[model samples]
Target: MKNLILLHGALGHSSNFEPYESFLSQHFNVHKVLFHGHGGSEIPAAGLSIELYVEQLQQYLEQQELNDIYVFGYSMGGYVAMCHALQYPGKITSILTLATKLNWTIEGAAKEVKMLEPELIESKVPRYAAQLMTLHGENHWKQLLPAIATLMTRLAVKPLLTQTQYESLNLPVQMMVGDKDAMVSIDETLFATKNIPNANFAVLPDTKHPIEMARPELLIGLMKDFWKI
Candidate 1:
């Protein structure tokens, strides 16, 4: 079986991919990565950043002796996966990204960052706050929010991948977004797909921003079709 890595989004735990893992494991040697500061993992002293995550991913790949791996990344994880492919070409055979935000601008990031405020989340969406605490660890979830906000701010300032860089990618890529996704726009996803020489784009119907809201059967079917497995 081919190796497959499932990457979760920011503030997301590896366990979030559990719904899809069991089915995917039958076809591939599935692996789920938990970035630092997530899922009870220790936060780096320098905090969470795209560069850090990519480096960690490289280490994971090396340690596991994985080669020509296939990746399915959700949201921020998708961005990191692309960066990893760019930084270390040929390591990943192909990629499938869902709801991954491609256009990072100062204005847009600021708007998104506003929604990540811990205080606001606790006050306005206590249930979500509690869920995050449970997912990331009761004590660590608060710190993770700010760290992720900083990461987003930095990404807006200096995006890891450029249009030209996207065009230069050698591996096949499939960019996908939910029709109802509020965070990532279809326009941006299409733009990325057009730039990448060997890339395609798709929009899931009735899908929302949250992975938990995604239709697992639909996503699994799409993955199998895209990966041809």
Candidate 2:
């Protein structure tokens, strides 16, 4: 059986995959990573970039002496996982991404950054702000808030993944999405699949951008199939 590492999206913590971890554990040994600056973990003042995040994960895998692992990432985490596979080929046996797309264009990413700027400037006390803050204590939040905004702005300036870059990865990849996913359109995802040498795509019926709310069973089934366990 392959060891598995699970990564969550922006504003999400390790607990985001709690609902499905037990199910996946039956098939693979699972370890969930809490993104840097997230879940109350120590973070650099500069916060995180996709590149930094992948390095952190790579170090973790190396320290643990874990290889031949499977990676399952959701949203932003999915992007990081994809990059890792490209940078460190043959290390990851298979990759599964949920509700994520590889076509992160500079124009589109900038628009996303524009949207988040207002939210960051609004104030840390807002309920929406709380959603991004997983750890307790105001000290950690105070330290992490600025980093998050800065990182968001940085991402806006540069697209994390591009079609040409994604085509470079030859790993087996499976993308699981929801039919009602408003964040990423199926058409956009299809464009990404065009160049991937070994890729599988699945859409859950009556689902939305947030897979948690749609149907967990569908995701679980896909995981089982992908892992063949």
- Candidate number of the best TM-score: 1
Residue pairs whose backbone atoms clash in candidate 2: none
In candidate 2, what are the lDDT values of residues 55-169, reduced to their tens digit?
Answer: 9889989988898899989987888898888888888888898888555556665555554543453474466556554442445665555565566566656766677766887
Query: Candidate 1 lDDT, tens digit per residue, 1-229?
Result: 7999989999998888988888889988998899898987787889789999999999999999998699999999999999999999999999999999989999999998899988899999999999999998887898898899999999999988789989888999999999999999999899999999999888999999999999999898899889887
lDDT of 1: 0.92
After superposition, the stretches of candidate 1 with alpha carbons farther than 4 Å from their true spots are none
* Local error of candidate 2 at residue 2 (angstroms): 1.4
Model 2 bad stretches (over 4 Å): 114-130, 134-146
Which residue pairs in candidate 1 have backbone atoms (N, alpha carbon, C) closer than 3 angstroms, thus clashing?
A: none
